[model samples]
Target: MASRTTSWAYRPSLDGLRMLAMYLIILFHTQVPWIQGSFIAVNLFFVLSGYLVTNVVLTEMERTGRLDLGRFYARRVRRLLPAALVAIVGISLVFLLVAPVVRRLGLVGDAQGSLLYVANWRFIAQANDYFAPNVDKSPFLHFWTLSIEEQFYVVFPLLILLLARSSRRGVMVAGLAVVTVASIGAQVYWATADPIHAYYGTDARLYQLSAGALMAVALRTWPVRLPRVGARAVAVGGMALFAVLCFSAVAMSQSNRGFLGTAACLMIVAGLMLDEDQPLAKALSLRPVVYLGQISYSTYLWHWPAILVMGMFLDVGPVTMAALAAVIATGLAAASAELLEQPVRSAKRLNRFRWRVSAVGVACSVLAAVLVVPTVLEREQPPAVASGTGGAAVGKLAAAHSDPLPKDVDWDRVDRDRGTEQTCQVDDLDRCVLHEGSGAHVLLVGDSHARMMTAMFEQLAKKHDFTLSTNIVSGCPWQENLRNTQSSPKRQERCDEARTGWYDTVLPRLDPDLVVVATLPRDHGKWHQRLENRDGSDLGLERSLLRATRDTLDKIEKVADRTLMVQSVATPRSFVPNDCLTSAKDPDDCVVPLTTTNRPSDAYYLAVAADVDAAYTVDLNPAFCPAGPLCSPVVDGMVVWRDNQHLTASFVAHQRAKVWRLIQQTGVLDALDGL
Candidate 1:
C-alpha cells in the first residue's frame, strides 16, 4: 500500500524552491550582470512536476487499486485552464489594441500554439530560437513549457497504471529500469541531432519527467534515510547546486542538452527526500514562500511578457524596470491566485462546468486572435516598406515606419518554405557557385558568417573583373580538423566524414587567388579538435588546420598578387526586427532601449587572421555599427533588432551601399585586378 499526504502537507520547502526558481528566471530575464542561465528554472520545474504529479497518481492508485483517469485529467484542467484563459484573453485584448499586423500575426501564431498546448512543437518547427531575448516578448512563449508538461501528463498516467498492475516487486523495478533507459536514450539522440527539436519534443523530454517518476517510485518503495548530522547539509548542498545552475549562464550553456539536465533532476530528487517534516521545511512553509508557490503558475505566466512589455515601451533602466515589473506582476498574480484560481480550483461545483467553458472560451479567443487581429491591423494600414532607392513615397513611408514588409509585398508570393526544406531553404544552405570574368582572384570560405561577406564582395567582384568562388556550407566551418561531433554516434561519424572530405577534396581542387576564411568563435575551454579519422588513424587536426590556412594563403599569393582576409562579423540577437511592435497598454511587454548595443565582439578572428600569409585584414564591424562604440540597431526609422540582437534582412539590405564601399576599399578588387 502507498501513502497519500493530508492534502495539506505543509511542504513549505517546495514553496521556497518555487520562489527561488521563479526569481532566478525573473532575474535572468532582466539581463542582470551574470545571471545568464536563469532559464534552467524550466528544467527544475519539469523535474518537480514529474515527481509531484507522479506521487499524486501513485498515492491515488494505492488507495483505490486503480487510477481515476477522468478525475486526474479533470483536476489538471481545473488547475491549468482558468488562469491560462485569463492570460490568453488579456494578451488578446492587448494585441488588438497595440500590435501592428506583422506583430499581431506572430502573437496570434504563439497564442494558437498555446491554446492547443502545442507551443513547444510550434516553436521547434519554427526553430523559434528561444534563447533570443525576443522570445520573452511573445506573451504566449512560456506556454511552450506548459505544453511540454501537459503533453507529459497525457502519457504519464497510463504508464503509472501499467506499473501499478505489477504483482512482483522485481517485475515493477525491471519495467521502470527499461522505461528509464529507453527514454534517456531517446533524449540523448534528440539532444545531439536536433537540439531545438530536443528542447520541445514531448518524447525527447520524457526522460526528465521519468526521472522524477522513478524517484517517486523509489521513495514509495525505499524511503531515503539521511544521517541526522548530514541531512540538513545535504539538502542545502543540493539547493545550492540548483541555484548555481539557475543563476550562472556559463553553467547553463554547458548543461543545456543532457548532462546538466540530468544533474538538475538528481538535485531535485535529493531535495524532495530531505523530508517535508523537517524544521527547515516548516520554515519554508512560511507565509511568503507558500504564497509564492500557490501563485507560481501565475507568476511564470506573467513575468516573461511583463518584462517584454516594459522593455519595449519604457526608457527606465532595465534593472529597475524589471524589478518594478516583477513586483507588480507578483502582486497581480497573487491576487489572481487568491480570488480567481483558488476559488474556481477549490469549488467542486465550478470545477466540472468551468473547466469545459474555460477550455472552449480559450480556444475561441485564440482563434479570433489569430484570424481577427491580423485582419484588423492589416485593414488599418497597408504593410510598411523598407527604405532603399525606391523614391520619395517609399522612402518617406519607410522613414515613417521601420517595418520592411512593403505595402505591396504580397506575403503569399513570398515562400515561407514549409514543405521539403522545413524552416530555412536548403538551397540557401548549399555552396554558392558564381561565374566570374575569368580566373579565380578571390575565395570565400567558412560558415554562414563568411557567406554573408559575399554581399559586399559581389559588387567588388564585378568592379575588379576577377572570378569569385565560394566554397561555403551553412553551419560547417572551414577548419579541416574539427569534425561534426555534436550529434549521435552514427550521425556524428557520417557528418564528420562528409565535412572532412569537403575540406580534403572539394577545396584543394578549386585553389583560388586568395582564400578568405572565417568562422564563429570557438569557446576555448570546451574546444575539442578531432584528432582521428573514421578508421582510427591519427589525423593531427591542429597541425592540418594550420597547414590548410597557410597553404591556401601561399597558393593564392603565388597565383595572383594579394591575399585578403575579411574579418568575421558579429552575430546579433534574433528578435531585433520586431521588438517595437508592442503597444502602450502592455508597455511592459515591449523591449527596453538599453539592450541595443553593437554586435558581439570580433576579436576571435585576429588569431586566424594572424596566421594568414601576405593578407590584409578588414573587419565589417565599423561598416555595420558605424557609430563606433555607440553603434546600435537602425532600420527604416526604428531599431531593427526585435530581440535586441540579429540584424533584420531589411537592415542588412538597407546598408548595401555602405557594405559595397567597404569591399572596394579592402583592396580585394585590386587582388582580382592583378589576376
Candidate 2:
C-alpha cells in the first residue's frame, strides 16, 4: 500500500468512522436505550478532528516547508461558519414565531454565544445542568462541540507553525503529549470538582484533540507497519471494545471518562493504520455509510434544533421524534452541503479575498440576531400598570367588586420578598436571620422549599415573639450525611458540607428552642432517580427519604425542645403566573387539580415523622388548597402560587392566622414561651 502522507488519498474508512460516530451521537441525543453512555461519541469526534486536522496541517508543511494560515482560516470559515450562521439565524426566526416569550428572550443570549463560538463557556457561566429535570433544552446546545473544534482550528495552527519553526517533528510530538497529559489532568480535577464546567470547558477537553494530534505525528514520523492479520485483529478488537463501552450503561464521570477517551483514541489509531482491503475497512467504505459521513457536519448541526422545534408543536413518541429528527436533519444537511458548503469550499477566488466577505456577513448576521431577538422579546412584554396598593389589597378590591381583575399583581416579584437575595443567603452554609424577636430562638433548616417558607415563617416568628435563624441551601434536603443524586455532584457535595458544617459547627453554636425542618417532599421522585451513596450505588427512594427524615428529626430533637416538619406544599400540575392570568378570559382557568399533581401527600410525611418521638408534621396543604378537588392559582384574587410549588408571600401573609393556629396546635409557641 502507498504511504498515506505520500499519496494524500481520500480514506473511505475514515469517512465510515465519522458516520459511525455521527450515528452514535444521534442515538445519544435521542436518548436511545442502552446507549446512555454514547455521548463518548463526542470523544471519538474530538480524536478524529485532532487526527484529520493535524494530518492536513502536517502534510501541507511537509510539502511546502511553510503553513498557509490565511488559506487555512478561510477554509475553516467557509466550511463551518456558513452552516452555523444559517442554523442560528434560522432557529432565531423559528423561536420568534413559535416559542413562548420567556424562551424567546433566552434565545438572544444563546444565539449570541453560539455565533461567537463561546457557547460552552456561556453554559458553564450560566451553571446550566445538562441532566437537570424540567430544564429548557437550548436548541443551540450542540454548537458547543463546534465551538471547541473552531477554537482548536484557531490556536492549533499557530502552535504548529511555532513548533515547526523552533524544532523537528519529535518536538511537536512531545508538545502534543504534554498538552494531552495536562488537559487530561485538568479534566480529571474539574470532573470531580465541577463536572458541568469540566464537561463543557475547552481546557478540560483539549486532551482529546491532543491525542489525535499525537497520533498524526506518530503516523507521519514513525509509521507503524503491522502484518495484515495483526492489523485486522487490532482494528476489529479496538472497535469491539469501543462498541462495548459505548453500549454499556456506565455513568459519565471524571473517574471513568479517561478510559473512554483512551478507547476512542485507540479506535481512531486502528482505523487509520489498517489497510482499506481489511473486512472492517471494507464495511466502513460502503456507499450509504460514506454518504452519511459526507453530510455528518450539517446533520450534527441541524438535528438538535430540529428535535427542539418539532417538540414545540408535536407530542409524538420517541421513535417518531427520532425519525422526524433524522429526516429533517438529513434534508437540511444535504441542502447545506450542496447549496452552501461545497460552493464556498471550492471557491478559490473567495480564498484569495482572505475570508473578509464571509467574516462581515457573519458579523452582520450575529449583530442583527442579537438586536432583533431582544427587540422582539421586549416588544412581547405586557404593559405594566402602576398601582399604589399591594397584591393583598388588590385581592380584596377584586373580591369586593367581582367585575374586572386588578392590575397590581406582580408575579415576578412574588418571591422577591422571600429574602433569597439577602446578604446572608450565600452559597456556603450561612445563617440568615429574617426576623428578630425578644423571645425564644428558632432555627429553620432544609432546602429551597425551606427558604420558600421563610417569608411566612418570619411573619410567624414575629407574631409569636421568637427570633428566626435560617440555615438553608436550595435543592438540598435537610438530610444528615445522606446523598441527593438528583442534584449535580458539586451540589451534592456542597449539601453534605453545609449539613455537616451546620450540624457540627453552626448548630452547636446557635442552640435554638425550636427547630423547623421543611423541604419539597415531592422531590422523592428526584431523589429516587438521582440519589446515590458514596460508592455511587442507588439509595432506594422510600428507604432514603424515610431514613433521612427520621434521622433529621432525631438530630433536631436532641438540639431543640420541640421539632416541626412542615409538609410539602401542593405542587400544581401547571404554573400559570399572574402575568399570564391577567389576560385570561376566566381567572379560574389558572386553577389546577390536586389529584393530577405528583406532590407527596400528608400521609407520606406522617409516616416519615412517625419514627421520631415528639416530632410533629404540619400540613399546610389544606390552607393552600382549601377547595378539595381543585387548587386555584388565585385565591381571593391574589395569586396563591408564585410559581408552581411555592406560595406567594402575600398569599402566605393572608394564610398567617391558619398557620399561626397550626403552630400553636403543635405547642411550638408554648415551648418558645417557656424558653
Clashes of 2: 2
Model 2 ranges off by over 4 Å: 1-6, 251-255, 355-358, 365-675
lDDT of 1 at 327: 94
How do the residues 72-163 of candidate 1 rate in per-residue lDDT, one tens digit apiece? 87688778867876776666565455443334444666777776688888877666445432122466777888998988887789877776
lDDT of each: 0.56, 0.68
Tens digit of lDDT per residue, candidate 2, span 343-436? 9788877866776755765676577567755675434522122112222223333442222345675655765645342213233334466777
RMSD for each of the candidates: 17.8, 16.4
Each model's backbone clash number: 27, 2
Residue 582 of model 2: what lDDT? 67
